[model samples]
Target: MAKYLPPLFTRLYLSLLTAIFASILLTFYLSEQFLQRSDVVDFYEDSLQVFIDVSSYLQRNGQTAEQLFKDDTVLDPEFEILWQKNWDANADCEHCKFLSVIANTAIYQLSDEQLLAVYPLQQSEEVILISDKPANSSIFSGDRRQQNSSLITLFRNDPSEFIPYLLLLIVIISLGTTLYFSVRRLQKQINQLVKVNQEFGRGELSARAQKNYTEPVNELAQSFNRMADAITETVSENQIFAQAVPHEMRTPLSRIQLATGLLRQRKLKCEELVLLDNIDDYIDDIEKLTRQVLTFSKLNSISNQCDHQAKQCIKLDDFLQGRIKRLVVDNNLSINLNLQALQLECDPAYLRLIFDNLIKNALQYAATHIEVNLKVSPKNLIMLTVDDDGPGIDNLQFETIFQPFSRLDKSRNQETGGLGLGLPIAKAATRRINGHLFVSHSHLGGARFSCQLPLKVP
Candidate 1:
């Protein structure tokens, strides 16, 4: 389950989203604190102004403090005036304070409580002003201890109070969506690079990463493309060199064969004849090696052109009969055939190469007889099986034999004339025609080379 977790981009996006929300919450908290402090200061300043205005009105109107205090409806909506005939030096309320002798007025500011102002009037009477909404007596009644408790209650009760949280949520969603797409875009590019790497690893030398993107990934892609180009060029050069050397050596090898043939025609001693035969054998080996190298080179070169090659609809039985007839006459081996008249669309040239190598390998190794079987499978695949009566190969050597220059211990003997490339060439030719080839222990007492070619080559 853990293995199926989200990839790197998703994890990074989640981490970034977490950080964004955390920062937003911290900013909201600090802003709320600052605004609350400013509200407190503004409340006290407004309360002081109200007290001064009420005192000035009493002095100018020539109205007695008792007349102003008695008429509650005549007072301003936000201010309330209270008259105390005797000023109490010791009050139960800790917020009450005495005025100075010179000014005879003092303001008391209580933490998390309402602001209070006391003004001494003539006749030893005192006027008190409290900073709170006149409609709510709970402000100074000690029921609400917090300065903004009512506002806080209103905020909690209102449905629109989630606006800030909602806005923050919207911002987070927008950011996450944008980051998701950006990361997906990057992931797509990285996937392309990975696919190209996989193709190159699978032996498609032309595979390359795309370099048309922004920044770091693009730079890496460009570097990868450059490296692929260099490797491809080097491999092409090596293949060309390999092909050229064999072609060059073939001409000299033919000359050697011609010279040995001429010597064989002349009269020679038994020992000389034997030495000449050995020379002929060596020449034959070199010629075979040359041919195999050229065939391998051609197979490699043809891979890129397989898509462009025209395929023909050919009768499988007729083709196999002709090829088998030639093999029987050339190798003087008894070959049995069990073929169905199946029609297949493929390159005949590639089929011929594949069959020629497999049959030749069987002819060289088989003790007595070779059996060929051809049929059309239910899946519309043309299955071909070539079996021989000889010592079968080890199961471990199945894949090894399909590799270039890979020979079994027994086949390494000089007399076999096996250059260890027959199966490799056959395998390459099989792939060129979109076919599969494998070997197993045959019922005929030797190795069976089974090939399955798609009926319709594409």
Candidate 2:
């Protein structure tokens, strides 16, 4: 669970829980106060009932004592005297008293017992006082004291009065502090990680993040590291191989090249010269092989070099005719050209290589005709198609035909001479120039290889 949640989310969850705990505490405090004060409300009601009983007793009529009470002579001829005598007796009788007094002598004067207050009501001129005197004559001071002290005790202990609000304030402050610190810590780690990433991107390969990555980023970094390590190791191995391979092949190739040159210059008899010609042919094949190996090595070293080189716009119809003319003169091969005067933007050397491989493949298998076609579209695309009347490839082998060292022809004889990297190298060169190459069935009942090149305007 801890790992599933980010630290920020975890902190937020804790903050919410803290807030809930505080709220619950505050609610409990209020509820407890309400329960405590319930008894005080009942005490107030009892005081009201005692006052009603005293009022009823004062209204009673009797003999001389009643007449004297009515005349206010024996009652000290003042309402205060009557009220005090009865109020004090009731306080003592009931043994509970909860009252206070506030008086003004200019108005009705107060006696010994503390007068709570006398305030005029809004609609009437009559003033009423709720004093620290018992309402009933029968209730004693001891009885009143019990109820009075209980009310004061309840007010003191009731949590609803202030504690709930105090607790809420503390909880808000604490949660805010916790959130602030957690955000600051997370921000610091994130900023540090970003800085490290920027340094690494700028070729500081040794740089690393302080905090562990958030899953996706970690996996991405791991993949990049793996790829970088593989490239580094492979480059080191290639450098070693490049140094050794040329030295090993150089001795044999130098001898073959020397023998071919000598044979070309010497004069001899017919049969003897024929033997020399055969030797010369074998030497030429060796030279070609050596050259192919060197070219392959260079291609491997810089696969994208073609894209960086300058390009020229060449006419397809004129170019094909020239190429076919050259091939017929050099290799004694017959050719037929079928193309439009379409212009293409490409590196001439690479484009020549593409057509050379396709034409050579055709010449090897073609019975009579090697058909070439060039198509153009308004969308800046040029398609070159080469077809031959030869044994076609199976659909299952189509994808494998483009692999290096892959050849459908089983025989490895001089008659069908090739290093098998021709087509693959052509494909790589085409890709470097952002071209597409694919093979399909031809009209001549053989394989048709088509290459599409984007013809951008100079």
Candidate 3:
């Protein structure tokens, strides 16, 4: 039964209801306690007032009854008068008995029937009975010798008693009803979210989570729909990317196969040898193209799956130095390095690609020198800049230069025969590492490519 129920809404509803009921019950109990206490205090004060009025009258008549009310040490008291003065002196006195009778008489002056337990002034041990009228017509009647001397008690438990309780019940029911509707509304919203999430998981990219017309759930629904639209667009792009792969590979593979057949015959001329070199270059480009696709796919796939892991940290200076050394030694491009000691959390292979493509493109255009600079900022940003001394890009075309298959010419003429995916590939790789890449005018009189990547602190 517990497993069948969804936990979040269940827990939320239970908690809210519990709090509401608890507050209602606690308030009811506390209010009742306060009312009862206040009633008791008010009754006690009335009894004290009656005692004072009667004692003042008796004192004016030279009766010793007034001496029975004051205590030495206590600041405020209600029952001290009941045992004040000598015990034996007023035990059998007629005057003391009369005084008790008069004190009890004063109680009937109030609205409610009041009971009194009075003691004598001279002998604090004797009981006194006082009333406004004779004993047969008295509303104030109680045993004066009763052990509990707090005799004046009034109770009013009419409609007022049940009114507050009814109000409390109403409050509880209101809260429970409110919580029930709220949970139902919340469950509906969650169902929409869950349905959309399930569709997404099943690769239904166009599916959306629709929401109620009257709530913020509508905004959330819109957001989910937007995300689904983006996912659908991305899926379409990837499908196109995957479909184009075979067509893109056919040209190079056909050339390599044909060139190999010709080479095997041993009848290849000097011109044919150059064609073989061209075939090898095509093979290399194809291989690199396949690697770029795989790299891009892996980066996108794993980015959503993994958190930042320190094991992925690459020492910035060492990693860049190694790549720079390889490019210089193997490609023989005049390259200079100015790198700093910085660590970065990233896949080292992908990071290498960003630099490799940038440098490779620079070498293709550079006339004399290629410069690489790496700097670590106090704000924990790793900045890498690569520049070349060649024909700089036209100011108007800088933004369009990074688009796939975009170049000075649409056909990408023999002088610049690349597919024009290098800058875009580099940009994608930079995004994978939560980095930014851009192009600007270079100090080397050519184009400069700069990347800002987050750093890993030791």
Instruction: Output the number of the TM-score-best candidate.
Output: 1
Better of 1 and 2 by lDDT: 1
Model 2: runs farther than 4 Å from truth? 1-216, 239-248, 256-279, 303-306, 329-336, 377-380
Model 3: colliding residue pairs: 86-123, 100-129, 100-130, 101-129, 101-130, 104-130, 104-131, 105-130, 105-131, 105-132
lDDT of 1 at 111: 38
User: Candidate 3 regions off by >4 Å?
Assistant: 1-216, 219-223, 226-230, 233-259, 266-284, 297-302, 306-311, 329-334, 409-417, 456-458
Q: Give the clash count for each candidate.
A: 0, 26, 10
lDDT of 2 by residue, 1-458 (tens): 76876676456667776777777787887887685455434434443444344445445743332243456443211122223222232432233233332222111112223223233323444332333444554212344334444645756867455655577677767876777676566556566666866655433445554426555556655665575566556765884586468668779777876876787687767898788778777766665666665555554453333444667878877888788776654344445566888877777777787887887787777776678888885666888898988887799988887786677865444466366777887786676566888999988888899988887632
Model 1 misplaced regions, further than 4 Å = 1-157, 198-207, 261-266, 329-343, 367-383, 409-417, 443-445
TM-scores of the candidates in the order shown: 0.62, 0.48, 0.48
Candidate 3 per-residue lDDT, tens place, 336-421, comes to 88888777776766687799888878877888898888997667688899999989888888888777667665664434756677
Looking at candidate 3, the ten consecutive residues that score lowest on lDDT are 104-113
Q: Of the candidates numbered 1 and 2, which has the greater TM-score value?
A: 1
